[model samples]
Target chain A: MKVGILGAGQLGRMLAIAGYPLEMSFSFYDTSGSPSVGFGDILVDKGGSGAKLEEFLNKVDVVTYEFEHLPLELTQKIEKLKPLYPSSKSIEVCQNRAKEKALFTELGIPTAEYRVATSAEELAEAAAELGCPVVAKSVTEGYDGKGQAVLRDVADAEQAWSSINHDAVIVESFINFSRELSIIAARSTTGEVAFYPLAENNHHDGILRYSIAPAPKVSTELQQQAESHIKALINDLDHVGILTLELFETPEGLIANEMAPRVHNSGHWSIEGAASSQFENHLRAIAGLPLGNTAANKPTCMINIIAEKGDKEAILKLPYAHLHLYGKEERTGRKLGHVTVQADSYEELVWRVKNVATFLPGSPEFISSIS
Target chain B: MKVGILGAGQLGRMLAIAGYPLEMSFSFYDTSGSPSVGFGDILVDKGGSGAKLEEFLNKVDVVTYEFEHLPLELTQKIEKLKPLYPSSKSIEVCQNRAKEKALFTELGIPTAEYRVATSAEELAEAAAELGCPVVAKSVTEGYDGKGQAVLRDVADAEQAWSSINHDAVIVESFINFSRELSIIAARSTTGEVAFYPLAENNHHDGILRYSIAPAPKVSTELQQQAESHIKALINDLDHVGILTLELFETPEGLIANEMAPRVHNSGHWSIEGAASSQFENHLRAIAGLPLGNTAANKPTCMINIIAEKGDKEAILKLPYAHLHLYGKEERTGRKLGHVTVQADSYEELVWRVKNVATFLPGSPEFISSIS
Candidate 1:
């Protein structure tokens, strides 16, 4: 079988790797043009001459993607010939903050109360209703904490207007929280559900720094609340692939900050920690197959190595951590690799993972103390 | 870091997968062309031509292998340039039955009594001394139960001479073994040892059919004995990388049946079932890094899913059993994929593994009864 991938990034390369074993072939349509090109025999298609792109895509059996930011029209066009997972409509709703907030309100799902702002005057009113210290975000194409800012006062709110640099933005009340957590799950066409354990996350510069599965200190009631909210979203969306919902654990209760409609970085531990990984499960769901178990094996904590390795080979010796690299060419601050460390207990897993990078000589001081 | 891999087959593909995260490039020099070309950029070298082979070998900083049938001359040549794991002596011993028996004798490692037969007259005398129900095997190039025959009487033993094709054969008493088991371990140059739990194996038509980790009924004493013997072999050979000891469980204790100088199939479960997988550990050993813990996370049973899947996609949906495919184009009885299932206990694990294949409706009739 042939599958057409919408992007030629690392995720696409990994998809090609998974497809190879199933006797499936892939053609990658990349925007970057230099994605792990030599790693797999992935035919590159860059909308090369309108006719050529169509011709290459025509030869495949299905279409999928690595991440969002795909043109909705391009995806819709591809959907006319074959299925596009998570559907272009699903992508449309989740891609922009404004659209996502509207959908959540329409579905009666609780979200940070918000409104759209077209100018500075609009920000004051939205913030007035939403409350001070609200978040102002570009309605579209923002990720990793970019294109967004917090409004603490009238002057702080003024900066939100110039920063959006677009026709529209959304202002949301910032929830006071104890910690941040996320739920990574997959839903099939048949509504079959597979959910990984809640992973507690800590971030730096808005990029995920560490994630540990089966988040400790989480009450059973909180976990159940998180799952029900996630199931409601997947069902409401009629989602057909993996979904990641990042949430805040507030004193009031669990409240979702946002959601991603694909395999997420925060779920990396599943590759070695779970009975079956989110990657394999995503493939299974996409292939119209049943999902594998999402149970954790040993207590596992995943540490992002960042683009910080001056000599990446230093990690070749880490005792209990499993390393995963994206096969991308080097550049400073690029997400080069990750290490998943597993242990007999959650504390030990956390302890070992936090100290792992120090083992690599000439390694930077990126790791933060967990204790 | 540089990783030199021997025999570029599917195992090399897997090693490449394990190596990518370290940013450590691999050079897989195959006597037959680059076998893992589909998954990684494999630089092929022509073995029949001497200069081309040496040029290819010059590219890698170290060497490891996917299969053990290495050309002694080529290996020796490569050894002059860089280290060859398992040592040339271990390869020489494993390559021939006569030499292997002699090494076992010298090492004081126990084995079934046997005699070398190079002629039909000698074959008769060997069978008489060992017993009528003796097994005859060609001394070299024997694997997956190939080039071996079980005899019942004098007439049956006479045919063994021709079956051996007059090549050197060993005549030995058939072992009354309770089960087949294997011990996989990695020893670094620093003398640190890491051992995977013993795994019980079941074979069909001479190929490994399945493996059960933490061998269900092995006593603590027997487990320790198996580990000690493996450690001694590693120290004796001063072995590097991974060493897999295939053994037979007898009434006395575990007896060494064969040894693989690299990762073994029985240890594949470590990918998800242990703190670190054998593949990851092998790379660690050769990279001159520390070894990871090998403790099993739960009772695990990995059942090989042969190529005859009625519908490969449909059957791959099992919740707990992680599946790995060799990327080989399928054929009758070919090794297409394997399913790994885990549970809290051995009995439950075996039972759960049996039903794991129910996800594949196209599987054979017996699959339902013996997943």
Candidate 2:
């Protein structure tokens, strides 16, 4: 079988690697050639050129996208040519923050109070109703903590609206969650589902810095609650691929944050730590194959190799540290790759994660907080 | 760094997969267009065509071969153009049974008694010295039980010689070993060495059928003995890549039967069962990178998906079974792919191996012996 992917990034590359063994080939549509150019000998339509897009779509049995921000019109066209996983409806909900937050509230999945605003006056009204300290975010074209601003007082509403560069926004109650957690879940066309252990994630400047799998010291009830909410989302969307749901663990309880309808960065440790990797499971889910085992083989900590290429030799010399360089050019604040360290004990995992982080440039100091 | 490889079969394909994560690209020289044609877009000199040989060599930093049978002249030419791992001398020794056995005996390694014969008349004499039921095999161009014959009586010499197409034969005492075992060992340019757990192998009609990792129930002393011999061979050759030693576990001890100077079929289970796969280690050794951990993570069995393209869906459904298809056209007796099953115990590994084997065509009945 052939799978058509909308983007040719590391996620698509990893997907291709996982899917190849299962007798599946990939054709990617992207402007820049996927650095994984040599992974398979298939045509890549530059910039999703209309002529090449039609040709690419005709060759694939199924279609999917690595990045969720692909234009809805393009995906709808792909759906007409072939089946697109995660469904256009799911993408529509995920693309618009208002729609995503609205759905969560409608489903009774706990989320921070929020309201849509199309003007500075309406933003001011939303801030007044939600009280001080609100976050105003552009409803579209936002990621990596961009296109959003914090308004500490009602007087800051005008500046927040201008900072986000638009009135098409979702203004929301600020969440003072103690921790951030995410669950990597997969659902097959047959409705069979599986999930990796919850991961506690840490972000630096809106980019994921580190993710510890099985969320050390997390309560089992909290883990079950995360899985339940994730189950409801996948079922509601009738999704047939991997989905990642980020959540906030606040004093009140777990609150729905946002979700990515694709294989996630938080689950990359599964490549070496889990019985079957999230990449493999995602490929299986979309290819109509049975979902694989999602249990972790050991406690694993994945530290992102952001912006700067690390001292590979030093990182590799660290025992049990598996390095994955994305074969991408390094730019400040860009995710180049990651390193995963697996150990028998949580203490060892933490130590190795820190040791690995030390080899990479611009690694967050939070890694040294093992104490 | 780029690594040049001769013969783009599944072994080279796997080597590319392992090296890509480490930021290495590959350029292969093969007439068959390398079954892994998509691994990289670098030039592939078809049949090592003289016109393109230098062109191909100039594009690579170092050279390695997936198989040992490349003509000595071609490899000598490649050595002059680029550094080839498992040097030309090592390849010369491994390409011919006479040289290989001589080296083994010279190194004081235990091996089957043998005599190099150039004619049928000399073969009869070798039988007299080695005793009846001798095996006559071609000194070169032999693999997978091919180009060999057995003589049960002195009178059968002519038939045996004719069976192997006459001359250039090595007649040896037919080994009646209890079991077969193999060890995958790696050596870097700096002499850093590591060995994966010994694998207990089973062969059907001289083709490897299945390999059980850590060679269930093996004595630690026996494992050490095998490693010692392998260490001697690599150090003596000053080899800088992975080499595999296949031995017969006889009642007296172990006897060196044959060796491949590259990744071996028996080590495929390391992909999932070990802390680092043999393919990855081979890439690390060749790239001048630090070697990875070789410890087996779990008990595992690898079954060759030989001669038949099995029901992929059924095979994939087997829990914890990792599938690897070589993307080859299947013919009777061809190795198309393999599946490795990891489990908590030997019994469970054996059971899963059989369950997976049932989905493939022409699988052996010996898989059920675990019961």
lDDT of each: 0.74, 0.85
- The CA lDDT at B94 in model 1 is 66
TM-score of 2: 0.96
What is the Cα-based lDDT of residue B111 in candidate 2?
Answer: 97
DockQ of each: 0.45, 0.64
User: Which interface RMSD does candidate 1 score?
Assistant: 3.0
Against the hidden reference, what TM-scores do the models get?
A: 0.88, 0.96
Candidate 1, residue B53: CA error in Å?
4.2
In candidate 2, stretches whose alpha carbon ends up further than 4 angstroms from where it belongs are A32-38, A41-51, B33-39, B42-52
* Poorest 10 consecutive residues by lDDT, candidate 1 chain A: A359-368
Cα deviation in Å at residue A318, candidate 1? Answer: 6.1
Tell me, by DockQ, which candidate is best: 2
B1-371, model 2: which lDDT tens digit per residue?
88888877788877877777787878877766545534554455666566667777888999998989888998898888788997998899888999999999999999999999998889999999999888989999899999998888888988888888945899899888988999989888778999998999988888888899989878889999999999999998888889999999999899999889999999999988887789888888877788888989889888898888788888767667888987777788888889889889888787787788778776757565544
B325-349 per-residue lDDT for model 1 (tens digits): 6666566666666767778887677
